[model samples]
Target chain A: MSLCEAEKTFILHGVEENFRIDGREREDYRPMEVEIGIISHAFGSARLRLANTDVLVAVKIEVDTPYPEKPSQGKLDFFVDCSANATPDFEGRGGEDLATGISNSLSDAYRSSKAFDLKKLCIMKGQKCWKLLVDILLLECGGNLYDAVSLAVKAALWNTRVPGVKSVGIDGKNVELNVSERLNDCVPLDVSGAPVMVTVCKIGEYCVVDPSAAEEKCSSAALVVAVSQGNITTVLQGSAGSLHPTTLMDSLGLGVEVANQLNIALMETLQSAPPHFDVGFLK
Target chain B: MSRKELLSKIGLRADGRRAQELRRIRCKLGVFTEPDGSAYIEQGLTKVLAAVYGPHQVRGGRSKAQYDAAIVNCQFSMAVFSTGERKRRPRGDRKSTEMSIHLKQALMATIKTELYPWSQIDVYVEVLHADGGVYAACVNASTLALIDAGIPLKEYVCACTASLANNDIPMVDISYQEEVLGGPTLTVAALPMSEKIVLMEMTQRFHLDHLPKVLKEALRGCKDIKVILDEAVRNHLVNVGSSSGWVKNK
Candidate 1:
């Protein structure tokens, strides 16, 4: 996918004209399609397709002892698996570096209590708590992975239902918990404060949101901003290029605005969809 | 044996399927645009996606390229959440490595490797759901992906699993529940047109006397699967051809 100098110049000119190569404005995002509750085995699941980049997320819940320092709060772990079906380059251990990068950024974004409250997942202080394992599978790489992964993760978390505990008995350093037998008796997490990541790619003199694969190659650097409730939760700089302070500030502002809009649209879509609706890969 | 009965007294299996019956198979070709060719198939609850990437120059280094025949490389992976219990890792385990080698063996037997000298064809299969017959599903899906890539093959390579039910009756296309119910399962990959067995693997060995009937049932299942896959390929070709105005003849 190496682009010649002429192709780079053409893309630069398009960005300067406020129209991207894909006929999108600087802050315009590619049309995204989201489906939830697709994986029947998982506690929660979501599949998001942002143009050609497809991401599948599934959340599984387990009961484990809470960390000593965070006894009152539960644990949330993110794991990313890059499937070879996405590309031959991801075969075997080739995609490990990229997978780790994405998972690390996600954990950083969700670490803040303001972004996602982990206390609700706690079942008992220091003894037992729920652990949410969010597994993300990358099926395609159109570009802008951070944004797509974050949105898909948020949707999966929204779909997660923690089994309700009817009773918790503790005696002599032993804890016994009774989970409800009814399948529908569960608690859904409050994801209103979950962060939505927006990648602001700097191409030429303009900043672009949701850069296509081609545009991404032309960009000197990019900023990944995770926004929760209109506040920046985590900011990550990617690529080997540097950004001026003013440009960084501008991209940050743009990232927050776009992220806010994306969050609203995502929530609306998740709420409007019918329960138990599944549009798997068959479509 | 404390195992539950795999076949009831009425000749119906646990899933209500009769002996020699295959699970419903649905597949689609060219499911992804990035790969040279891609296909997705679902055999009952087992879902697999396969992608073919080469026939170009070998990757990594030129030293690994074979001068006589093109290398057929295969990788088999399962999603962590594909099973009833979440897998700790997607791949790199001993079981996956064995499955990868077995998959390559099956595909290599059908592909015409000598046609493209010093090149390589990489086939990757990812299991999204693993109800049973994961290896068989991978082989079937890879065959379709190779066909979609326009790779030359001697014939359609189909795989199936068979088990002895009620000590004499043979059942085809064993599911995960049946596999766990304690039965000797035999898996066979074959080229149905030529009736050549590419690979045969068995788990929990049964009496050698019972092998012939089980193997026959598996081969029959493979032949039936070949018919379904062949029809699917033709239908897919028609749809792709028609959509691009390929109907107009010179």
Candidate 2:
């Protein structure tokens, strides 16, 4: 993704003019295409394509005993895999760093009880709990990976369905639970408070959301802010160059503002998603 | 693990296809703009995507470059949700590493590496779903991606899986259900025109007398795949040519 000096200058000047090379406003996000229930085997799945940054998320549920420290709460685990199809650099264990970084940020964003509630996943007090395993795979890297990954995770969690427990039997320290056989007996997860991350990249002096790969190369610093219902849940700074405190504050404000709007649009789109017609890479 | 018959009395497979019939194959080339070449393929329930990048200076270090032949590096990975049960890791696992090595071997036999000395070509395949014959699908998709990259090849390399049904009848293109039901699976990747086998692997065991028949069925399947891929290449060229107005000029 090397940009020549003149190309960098062109992008820097374009940002200073309040317009990006692709004619997008500084605060505007690229058109995003999202598909739900793409993975059949998983309890819930979603694929999000923000221009070329492609992400696929799947949520799998397993019942297990709750941790002694948190007997009333279930568990949430995030795993990220950066496929080599995105780039040769991600082959084998090469992408572990980036995958770990994204997964950790997601863990942090979902840590606050306001953003996600683990208690709802509990099946029984101190005995059985549903563990939600959210796995995200990156097929392509066009930049703004944090935002794309976060959105896909949220969508997947929203689509998740927890099987309903029909009965629980306790006999001699052995507890057995019967899950309902009916398909509609499953419970949909509560994702109203799921966080949505926005990447505010500072290109020259102007901060932009959803920076393209070319713009990302020109920028020296960026702020990733996760917002849940107009409240900031997590903030992480990725700085390739130093930034003033005032500039950081400005970027954070813009990130939260854009994230709130983005959240509304995402919910609307998910609500009005078209009926399934077997969509995937084939289409 | 059901005792249900794999092949019915009429000779139809579990999916209702004849023993000699391969599953439906649908493929598209140049699916992504970022990669030098990209392709997506669906063989029945198994779906795969392949991307090719290279014929340029080797990254990392120059010592890995070959003096007389180009380096072919391949990585094979599957999505965590691709299998019936979730996979803990996509790659770096023993199965994936073995698949990657086998993929590199099959592709190296077809690509013309002498023309681009001191360079490397990276072929990466990601499986979106796995219902069986995943390796074969990866090989096919990588060939299409290499073609889209305009890399020279001696001939197209295609792979197919075959197994013995009812302990006697040979079947082509074994699905996940068939593979699990029981029987030895013989996977062969070869150049159909030359009738040269680039790589071969057999799982489970059968009578020595039945080996030739199963191998022949697998090879025949590869040949059939080559025909389908050749047709796809021609159709792709026609579409690209027409869209570029090359055909109109003529």
Candidate 3:
């Protein structure tokens, strides 16, 4: 992703004009394509392609006893896998740092009870709980993984169809569950407040949104802000360089403003998604 | 795990496929914009994506360059959510290492290595979902990616799985259900036109008497898969060639 001097100048001038090299406005997000239920075997699955950045998210549920500290609530675990297909550098354990960072932020974003409720996932108090593992695999690294992964996570959650429970019978110490009748019934997960992360990269005294590979190279530092329903969930300042508190605040404000529009488009995109639409790499 | 339980009384497998039938295959090439060649394939529930880069000078070390052939480097990784339970890591695992080695061996046999002497070609494959036939899918995917990269090949390298079921019947392209139920799973990667087996891995044991039929079924499955892959390649080339204005000039 090396940038020549001329190419760097062109991008800098474009940023000064508030128009990115891709012709996107400061608050505009690249066109994103999303598909749900692409993976049949997984309980819930979605694939999101934002320009060239591609992400696939799957939700797998398992029954387990709740933690003693949180007996009544269920569990939400986020796992991110950066595959080598994205780049040759991520062949071995090289992508662990990026994966761990993304997963941890997702965990924190969903920790808020308003964003994702874990209580409804409990099958029984203290005894049985549905542990949902939201696994995200980064297939491509065109750019902006946080946004792509977050949007795909929200879509996968929406597409999730929790199995219907028929009835439960508890006898002396034995519990017999009868769940055969409501096989077709399903419950969609609540994801209205799902957070979407927007990254603001500081390049040459100016801040830009959705910086591509070349732009990222010139930028010495960046900040990632996760916004949920107009509120800032978390802010992650990244790069080998440092950011002052004032610059951090400025980036957070920009992330918030851009994320509001980003969230609206994401919600609309998911809502207006065409069912039976062919979703794959060709498009 | 009994011999009779390998297949049902109705002559159907655990996933209800006939002994000679193969799972459905769906694939798309050029899935990404950055890679020189990329493809995504689904054989039943097993989904794999492969990206090819090179025919250029080797990266990392030049000492590994071949004198009169291209150095083929391959990496095979499966997503943590690819299996029934989430995996702790994607690569460096025993199964993944074996898969990578098998992929490189099969691809090296098919690619025209002499044309790019002292250069390197990289084929990276990621398995998004693993139900069964992972090895076969990865081989097929890498073949398509190589084709997408415009790298010449001796022939289409195809792979398939075979299993012995119900003592007499042989199953082609065994699914996850059939794979775990019982019997032997024989995986073969072959250059379809040359009918040369590049790599063959067999798991479990079946009587020597059943070997012929099961091996034949697997070969038949490989040939079938070759047909599908060949058609895809032709269509893709046509689309790419025409869209590039070559036909207009002609």
Candidate 4:
């Protein structure tokens, strides 16, 4: 994944001409395969393979008291574990910092009401609510991790079916809730507004989406844009290097445009697809 | 006290398996393109992913590198959500550390270390789901990935788990249900072609007299798995050769 000056120039020239090494255009996304319910033990699970970047997302829901500030809203915790399987560099706790960073960003991006509505998860005010733990494991890192993770998480939530409550019984200090026997009576999560984060790296003169590991090395600064239903959720300026104000603004504009197009394509693919049985890793 | 008692009146063991049966094994190789070698294997409900990346130069301190042997580094981690209950951390636990060491031991035995003297071979195994026999699944998957990376090996390293159901009938491929039923579980990792057992582990006490039968059942299972894996490798090579226009007229 090392990118020298010569290699960077070759990529830049290819991007300028609207063609990539894999014969993809500037806006073209690599072929992706999404499968749900791979981890049978979890309530909801999905794995997405966007080229070489493989992301596995599993959602585990448990009943717990709601937050003091947001009494009616449920909890959504995100954890990104960069497994050593991804690379030798991520061995031990080496990847902890990056994993934490990705998890925190995901939490923030999905916190806003414009993105994901957390209120529906509340079962009974502050007493009883569902806590959805979205655990993301990074299996490989070819590049474009943000896109792959988001897609997998979204798909996992989509396939998640929450158990139905038939009745609630408050007996003394203990409260019991009844459920239906038919599993089909469960409710699925509404993910129409789930934000999809796209990492747009500013390499050399032009900005690019879905940068491979080599392109990422050459890039000075990057922008992470979270788009939900064509509306921008959050835009975070990243990268250790600096970016001019004008270039930053330009990057933001392109980010939103590309995010919108990405969403449309994503929705079209998810909606028209059949039930995916070939889970990730297994594929 | 007989086969009927071992299988019970329902004709099923503690985990509901026939005495001479194996757990369902679902596997895939080259699951990731970034890694030089990667594979995912699910034996029954236990799921493990093994990745291999090297034959390349050894990183870090040069003093550790041997002039005549390739260093094999292994790390084993299980997902927090993998078990029945949540785990505190993925690795660094006592069980994970032990598993990691055992993995290194198993892989090193098969990989031809002498071929790449000063180079380091890294094998990382992650357990996504834990039913039982985590080490065995990891070892098998790692073997597939190493072959996928085109690394030379003395023989295919296959692993399997066995447990004495009702103290006599040896059940091949133990599952979570069997493990929880308080039986004598034995796991073995071996080079099947060489008939050499590289690693052998057992949890709980077992009768010395019944050990031989259990070990024999496990080895049979390992040999069966090795055959399947060999066939898969051959099929994969054929597919790649035909697609790359290297299809030879047979």
Please report the candidate that would top lDDT against the real structure: 1
**lDDT for position A263 in model 4:** 72
Model 1 regions more than 4 Å off = A275-278, B1-3, B248-250
Tens-place lDDT per residue, model 1, A145-229, is: 9999999999999999999999999889999999999999999999999999999999988899999989999999999999999
Residues B205-236, candidate 4, lDDT per residue (tens digit)?
Answer: 87899999999999998998898788877877
Give the least accurate 10-residue stretch of model 1 chain A, judged by summed lDDT.
A274-283
Off by over 4 Å in 4: B1-6, B14-16, B247-250
lDDT of 2 by residue, B1-250 (tens): 1366778888888888999999999988888878899999989999999999988889889999989999999989998889988787788889999999999999999999999999999999999889999999999999999999999999999999999988898999999988888878899999999999999999998899998998899999999999988888888888889988887543
- Candidate 1 CAPRI category: medium
Could you give candidate 4's fraction of true interface contacts? Answer: 0.79
Candidate 2: regions farther than 4 A off? B1-4
Clashing residue pairs, candidate 1? none
Q: Model 2: clashing residue pairs?
A: none
Report lDDT per candidate: 0.93, 0.91, 0.84, 0.84
Tens digits of per-residue lDDT, candidate 3, A1-283, equal: 6779999888888887888889976666778788888876677989998888889998987777799999899899998988878887776887889999999988988888887889988777777777888889988888777878888998899888777666667787655555546646767788888888888988777888887767777776898888888888888876678888898888899999988888787778778877756455545
Error of 3 at B234 (Å): 0.5
User: Model 3, which residues run further than 4 Å from truth?
Assistant: A166-181, B1-17, B248-250
